[model samples]
Target: MQRQFFRYNAKSFPKCYRELATSSSIFLIFTAAIAGCTNSSLATKQQPATTQLFSPQTHLASQPPRCQTAQLSVSKVSTNAGAGNVAVIYAFTNKGSSPCNLYGYPGFALLDSKDRPLKGVKVIRSQGTYFSKQQSPRQVTLAPNGQASFEIAYNQVRDVGQSCPTSEKIQITPPNAYHHFTLPEQINPCTGQVRVTSVQPGIIQ
Candidate 1:
């Protein structure tokens, strides 16, 4: 009777074993999906921290002086007949070891024998390749031990037989971003007794 009972259970065991095997496979697939999502979240959290470490910093220095010295010499002068303009040429050399940036329009004031400011003296307006844009005035960047020339036009004539002393001063303004230097007043020595003659046109040669 016991052997007959064992044989009856063994014949139905195949169906029960199939149900157990299917359930085990579904459980394993669900566990793998959960693990993949967990790893993806970890990677996203670390990305921002890595980017912050390599970001650049923002900092700036101040501007330097425009011209190193107060001394400037007049290299050439001429008159324009059509426009009634006087073209003045100036040569500047870097006496120091550093470079400089020139700014502002050149102005001239005629002086009498006593160095008094003479009115109505025209410093002709220059309309040439050298005229700087109103927004960004003429700026010459001189290298270490470098030299540059500046041309300016004025409306004033060199009055004939009139003994007048002429001098020029350059004004430098700092850049908009930073302020490192001051635009101090620089005065050139008087070129004594410049006699005005007939207005002519041509190069200073």
Candidate 2:
């Protein structure tokens, strides 16, 4: 009886040892998997980020300068008559160091003895042989120290009383629709019409 009991105890001891070994192997695998997951999460959080910056030297080098005007002067004036009206001719010269490109129409304002602005002055295009609101002289490319001419007509001489001064004030405006590389200058009041024959270089056109 004693021998049979010892044999049973020995057989049970081997089975118990096998079950303990299996449980220990499973626990070790689960702990290793959890440690690997934690390491991956930490690496993702520690990654670095990127950014950009600007400097003064880079900003200024990217921008362009503004346009400037050249000087202008009135050179000559002449007068003529239509069937029932009078006309005045004006010659202007550019005496600047740079070329000037003329843009848009040219108009004039007649001033009374008191310097009051008068309206209804007509600009005539001798080259076109026609009349309109105002003649934007051709896009004249005036070389440094060059000259150009334009005419103004008064449909009725009576519009300007006999005592009125022959000269008129003129303002040469650049084309509003386009960007000008150079600007136009203002012509002071002169006899018959404002004549711009000479101008300082770098004057706004």
Candidate 3:
């Protein structure tokens, strides 16, 4: 029953909502990631400009601190729907004076009118969606008043005798941040599944 409204590497962005164990498997994955980064660096000499532009670690010392929820704000910019699926694009504008960075996927939770989490809903991060083809998560630098965006997409199918659960608001926690804020938007996803893309530069269509 899987269709391609959104796509992601399960290896890179697993079920992020759950807690991970501090085990050898985690250590091995980290080791592999570092190896991959090192290998990419070897090719950097061949593509100096490309490497400098996309590689966040090239000037890691100069990169701004991670964007905290206190330094930014989110808005539901626009939405697209078709072929029984819908995608919503949201932007996080840097409201603080200092520049900051955002990388990877934001955490999301749908809450009912009473502020309890909606049951039976699943949310996972994706690398791309039907509306946009984007790269894997990279550091998105946000200068003062600048923005980075991501998309939340889901299927909207209903069965014959039951109605989808109603959500009265949306909760968003920026990547690597512990706290969250809520948006007063209603949602009703019948399939109980949702996909979110990693944060990227500017507003993505």
Candidate 4:
């Protein structure tokens, strides 16, 4: 009798109602699948992208190239003495056809009469000393055939000591540059300190 009752109810139900129930179940399943797919897509987008690493040399190589050493010319313009110090002005001229930038203090080294690198002394960037007031470094742009200047200051032999270091050649490397040029001029570096100024636009007076 229970089986007969169940069969009778199933048969009594409208065919459309049965079909609707089946469709509803299918729709619910389809909706859940769509929602799950959407969530997966969102998670993919939220994930962090893969990053690439680089070394200092690699990073610098990736940047826009700066002025090269071959595109510049270095020369000495003047030398002066006052108090217990000597000031020497060196000029940097851009020989390249395009404009280039110069920044920071130039790297310098003293060379002896034999054109050998001087020892026990290194070039130091200075905020003006007794010889010259402190001058801040600034970016100097040079057009083709344009020029910039920098000064070096050191103490005299008498002020430093009888055994002061003497240099007949000055080697100069532009700021952030590797190649250097030499100035075959007589210079006596005192024991106090050697001061180097940043590149300046124009001829040093």
- The C-alpha lDDT values of all candidates are 0.42, 0.45, 0.87, 0.80
Minimal lDDT window, size 10, model 3: 13-22
Model 3 C-alpha lDDT per residue in residues 1-205, reported as the tens digit of each score: 8876766545665555323544567888999999999999888856545443577676886769999999999999999998888899999999999999998999999999889999989887789876778669999999999999999988887879978877899999999999888999877888898889999999895
The candidate, 2 or 4, that scores higher on lDDT is: 4
TM-score rank, highest first?
A: 3, 4, 1, 2
**Can you write out model 1's per-residue Cα lDDT over 18-128, one digit (the tens) per residue?**
678778989899889888888888887776533445333332124445654442222333323234334444444555666665554444345444445544344333334
For 1-205, candidate 2 gives per-residue lDDT tens digits of: 3555434454566888978878999999999999999999999888787777667978866443221233555533555555654445454465677665554344344453445454433333233222323333345555667655655444433344454334343344222223222212222222233322212222222
- Taking all chains together, each candidate's TM-score versus the true structure is 0.39, 0.39, 0.69, 0.66
Provide the lowest-lDDT 10-residue window in model 2. 196-205
**Inter-residue clash pairs, candidate 3:** none
RMSD of 3: 33.9
lDDT ranking from best candidate downward: 3, 4, 2, 1
Best by TM-score: 3
